[model samples]
Target chain A: LAKTTQPISMDSYEGQEVNITCSHNNIATNDYITWYQQFPSQGPRFIIQGYKTKVTNEVASLFIPADRKSSTLSLPRVSLSDTAVYYCLVFSGNTPLVFGKGTRLSVIA
Target chain B: DAMVIQNPRYQVTQFGKPVTLSCSQTLNHNVMYWYQQKSSQAPKLLFHYYDKDFNNEADTPDNFQSRRPNTSFCFLDIRSPGLGDAAMYLCATSRATGGYGYTFGSGTRLTVV
Candidate 1:
């Protein structure tokens, strides 16, 4: 399983765009990058996923470089409710999703 | 909406006692997973069942066991509970072949007394 490293925590003001980057230098060729958002006392929810380049959704955008060593999750126009812990995971077929110490984002009004 | 559901959102268990947590899914997903999440910590995989095949994480303790009777229901059985076992247990489901994201339940908060 590939390990991931992310910032321990980050703070952003409401209406600002927040980008959380994850480094997985040992990422494998078949590994896909996925981001999950978890609020207090709630389960982690899928935000976005991508294998390479940029993949945008209604909720967030995932940017993966050609090397696939790193990926960024971009949240546009953040709100107070967006405060949560975000996890970056890398997994392939039949591989269990291993979670690392996620990035805790604090959104302030 | 099709979703994963965990019964008994809150449970209080006695130390050294056996307890079971139940998870049922309406999505009919082929894979079901159990995860333990402590306060301020990342969720750890305990075990998962791909159809009828059970896969346990190497780091997971022997006291933690699971059962998947069919496609929709899976159970987490703790043979002997300890104070350290008290945490939020989350159940998630995903398709077996697509390698897509998991759909997680709200989680069952277990307290050991």
Candidate 2:
């Protein structure tokens, strides 16, 4: 399993774009970067995933560089409801995932 | 819509008492996972069942056991609940190894008294 590093917390205003970056220098060849958003008392929700380059979804976008050592999750036009703990995971075949503390994004008014 | 479902939503148990938390999925996914999430912490994987084969995490305690009667149902048994064991237990499922789009249940909040 690959370990990920992210900011402990971030503060952003509503209607602003928030980008959370994760670094996994030891990412393996078959590893895919996945992001999840978890609200208080709720299970983590899948936001976006990408192997390389950029992938966009109805909720968020994931950008991965050629190096594959790092990835970023971009949330557009944030609202107070967007405040949550964002996790970046390096997923591989059948391996149990390990989540770090994650980046807690606080969308302030 | 098809989804993962956790029963009771909340549970209160006495210290040192045994309790069971259950999960069922209508998605019919091949893999079922159990995770423990404490307040302000990340979800920790306890174990998972792929079909009938159970996989336990290296650091999981013996007190925490799981049983999967079939594909649709999985249960987590805490042999003796402790105050420290109070947390949210989440159940999830995936189609296969290296699978995406995992479906997670709302979870059961366990409170140890």
Which runs in model 2 stand beyond 4 Å of their true positions? none
DockQ for all models, in order? 0.65, 0.69
Q: What local lDDT score does residue A59 receive in model 1, on the 0 to 100 scale?
A: 99
Give one digit per residue, the lDDT tens place, for model 2 in A23-83. 9999999988889889988888878888999999999999999999999999999999999
lDDT per residue as tens, model 2, B1-113: 99899987999999999999999999999999999999989999999998999999989999999999999999999999999999999999989856377778999999999
Q: Total clashing residue pairs per candidate?
A: 0, 0
For model 2 chain B, give the 10-residue run with minimal summed lDDT: B95-104
All candidates: TM-score? 0.98, 0.98
lDDT of 1 by residue, A42-95 (tens): 889988989999999999999999999999999999999999999999998878
Model 2 misses residue B95 by how many Å?
Answer: 0.6
Error of 2 at A38 (Å): 0.5
Error of 1 at A101 (Å): 0.6
